[model samples]
Target: MSQPGVLLDRDGTIIVDSGYVGSVDRVEFIDGSIEAIAALNRAGIPVAVVTNQAGVARGYYGIADVEQVHKHMIAEMARHGAHVDLWLFCPYHPDGIVQAFARRSADRKPGPGMALAAAEALDLDLAKSWVVGDSPSDVGLARAVGAKPLHVGPAGSAVDNVDTFADLAAAVRFILGDGELAMVTRDERPVKFPAARFHRADSYGGAYVNELARAFATVDLEQVSRAAKILNDAHDRDAAIFACGNGGSASIANHLQCDHLKGVRNGTGVTARVLSLSTNVELFSAIANDLGYEHVFSYQLQSQARPGDVLITISSSGRSPNIVRAIDWAVANGMHTISLTGFAGGAARRRAHVCLHVDSTNYGIVEDAHQACMHLLAQYVRQSRMTPDAVASQTF
Candidate 1:
């Protein structure tokens, strides 16, 4: 049997909820949160954060913001002798404006996706673990995974039949046998990438473009539709679209800006505001010289971006630090994010709200597909807004 652990929530449980918190300055840690985790850490218990970041789907923020906040949270916890072993967030919400995430996801609270995945990865014994949060979903999650539930806050008082605590300190005390809580045994399963076979395949570019096309066929259309809706809605709301990338992806980002700002405007008269982070050589050099290369795009975003802006990141490998950092800052400020990536679809692929991924080995194939994705969104928004009578002759 695996060891026990604690699955904790984010907003309102460990941290005070400020309605879609995006910036690092806004992360307010709940009283005793750090100490409670420290208590668990001392007991050799594994800790995992399981929360629903619906803001990512609602266009209030992006997943990069979540990652950045979690990073900050971890650093703060470490200072107090606590460590969170796992992090799981479900960005999807049924009523979200971003089409890609506008559906029910198993990872959402009241569902066991996060707990189950963490359990499998860490070899956690669910029967011995505890679900700690401030909502009914938290209790429901415990039931789903066969873990004990510790409902926190006054809201939990309304719940009929579950363990309740006034705060983390109290819960930890009770769980500790004297005062508060729990624990992991881990499974070492390596990440397997069968898609890597495209690199070794026989024929033209290893028949890579064909492989890319085939892989794209499997992408969920709901995600694309969600992305399209995010773009169009941004256009309607007169929001800015910030795009970032590196190398060929940089060119693609710039080209995407042109298409969204010009093509979409010409086609739909929506006048989408677009900017390319790959541009602004002067400020980019200044930041890269002072803070480091990764700060260039993010610094610009921190100063210029406002809530409800859109971020479009074209990172063929999805691992570029600068690109990822830009997305991180943008999301924290309530920007809707779209990522175009390839290969194993690195961090950006997972962090962005809308992911347009081309699974292939060749850079040329990935960039080509990314370019097509940009055009697809620009044209999609244009066509959606155009008159029915103009649809036939307006597009090629």
Candidate 2:
């Protein structure tokens, strides 16, 4: 096998983390970055850039802009006698506002997908490779691929329990065995929630509830507040709110329409116009049978949705093709989009304008959280418009 290569993270590691850097003019190589790459090149180690460009998904820039920046990076590195063998960037973010660029991708950092790709492309043995970066996600990528992780950043920025270096140059010296620094033996790595936790529990029900509480804490309260405001604004303008989901999530979608429409309308003077795209079983089946399942929600949106409307998608995994397509269509057609997601907040979460994500990997916990989110939004919107006396007198 060939000597192990190095996978580098772009922002903060190779270059300064200029927020959402798109143009070449904004690309600033961190001190010693060029020299570091040159050192790798001199040692005949292949180098590849594996970075996430969520700015594209956020509608701050386009893919071409990212490529342009990379080109500039290559030229700058070349001037310093460094050469990058490959440049790989992930342009998908689940929370992007742009219709075309928004979605989830396997190549995103921390997933090991991009690392596997770089291994294949560079013919490098991942187990012997080094992943150098400045964030926990970078270390996570290394761990996922069974590579040695080298964290480079300011002294205080070191991730706990990981080997840390002052900069890329320092990390490079360590890799080449020319440094006085000592490499720490790792005793810990990122771990997944064990299914055994349920089986070995003294009380399975109590264990489940405890997990649920932890998941609930992960829900961004700020996002929930933002969603409430979106619903409020939609009601104020009389714009329609449409929701869709699959399987367990489908039930939440239908329930959302009912509560937001009838439940929110009774006490609150605000008349909410809501529809569940997943409610029409015949139409959904027809769309699925004819146009493919991915088009089910989006197909319905095309018929009745208009600009300034709202779309709310509920999916536990949030990677459902149909949910992603619906968010894509909604954003493209100038509609406000929201998604309730669980388990890593999949493409639907990134694609939506607002995301209320449940952080649990358990299906039951996530679905229950999503259902609670639906009810909370409906009730909040209702109470916001009602007088204190009216709120006191009315049943939610």
Candidate 3:
């Protein structure tokens, strides 16, 4: 019989995420990580380190550098009497800068290529195995291979409905079935975002522009792609896409209605249907005055939204009561939920099916990024229906 094994994520799980760690000198193992591996080794369970090395594809480092670091890792573990049966890393990304490594590969995290290879090489049973990591992609990799998933991150990081641990040691204990190490439940509270990034700049223009560029770099293109697909699906089915937000986010939500409706319909084959819950002042004021302020969006959703419609909520803090309520309502009613969140994505981020998160603490930066996202999605969906020649010739 093939034996059960464990698949472990490298950075942020077994070691600290020092950002594209390419050299052995920067390898900093997490506390208790060595002991945790030793415990697994003692139990006669095979372990494999499966990681995504996007740095290699991004031209930050080469495959040789990655291999050297892996070798260093293996040596470090050996000195401590722990053994990792296999080491696997995926070095491909669709938007990578290195031509040799740039392109999509099934070996990437959330893809089953590496897991399948490890299972075969190690004579293991994936159905009985555990995949532990600190990111959503790690959980996704587990699901893709039918393995048990354990998250190792903060109290409320966005990958929902999975077993979470404070660190790798705790996750290891759970995998070993230690009775004292009970699984930790997610707090589901709003996480605190970092301090302001542009406050200390020498000049306003330079600081603001640089901060915006940095924040934009952290935006997940994959999440945006998923959200675009959802919007397109709704458009194809002739379902209304509802948008809501408050203050600056409200403006973005209102703008979304314009771009998604008129902007996407001009040359597109489909007629887009969109509504902004934040735009109707008379009805919104009545709902806030009568029912409650938090009921503004949900109340509208209940009356107009259908099962297959889409809800897009924009919130800088992501914890606005009304926004959270609307997302919950839409999800419960079978409508697709997408959220644009910044400053430690809160309940709305967690509840939404797709979260386009802006990793900025400043409200202006977040709102600016959200506006760009709205425009990108509208244009993408618009051009998706047009011929390449027409798209090239037409003004956006």
Candidate 2 residue lDDT tens string, 1-396? 544889999999999997989999898888778767755654456799999989998988888899999989888765444668889988888888987767777788888888899898888999999999999999999998899999999868988778899988788878866642222212211112323223234335544565566567668999999999999999999999999999999999999999988898887666778999998889989999999999999999999999999999999999999999999999999999999999888888888889998876778889999999999999999999999999999988
lDDT of 1 by residue, 1-396 (tens): 477778998887889988888778999888777767755654456789999999989998888888899999988775444568899999999999999999998999999999999999878999999999888999999999899999889643646787788877667666766412321111211111122122223323423433445445535678789899888788889888888888898899899888877887775677677999888788778999999998878888888889998888888789989888887787777889988888778999888898987755457767887887788878888788888888877753
Ten consecutive residues with minimal summed lDDT in candidate 1? 183-192
Q: Which portions of model 1 show Cα errors greater than 4 Å?
A: 1-206
Pull out the clashing pairs in model 2: 57-96, 94-350, 94-351, 95-350
How much lDDT does candidate 1 score? 0.78
Winner of 1 and 2 under lDDT: 2
C-alpha positional error of residue 329 in candidate 1 after TM-score superposition, expressed in Å = 1.6
TM-score of model 2 vs. true structure: 0.52
Q: lDDT (CA) for every model shown? A: 0.78, 0.84, 0.84
Total colliding residue pairs, candidate 1: 15
Model 3 regions more than 4 Å off: 1-23, 26-202
Give the number of the best model, judged by lDDT: 3
**Compared to the true structure, candidate 3 yields what TM-score?**
0.53
148 Cα displacement, candidate 2 (Å): 36
- How far is 191's C-alpha from truth in model 2 (Å)? 6.4
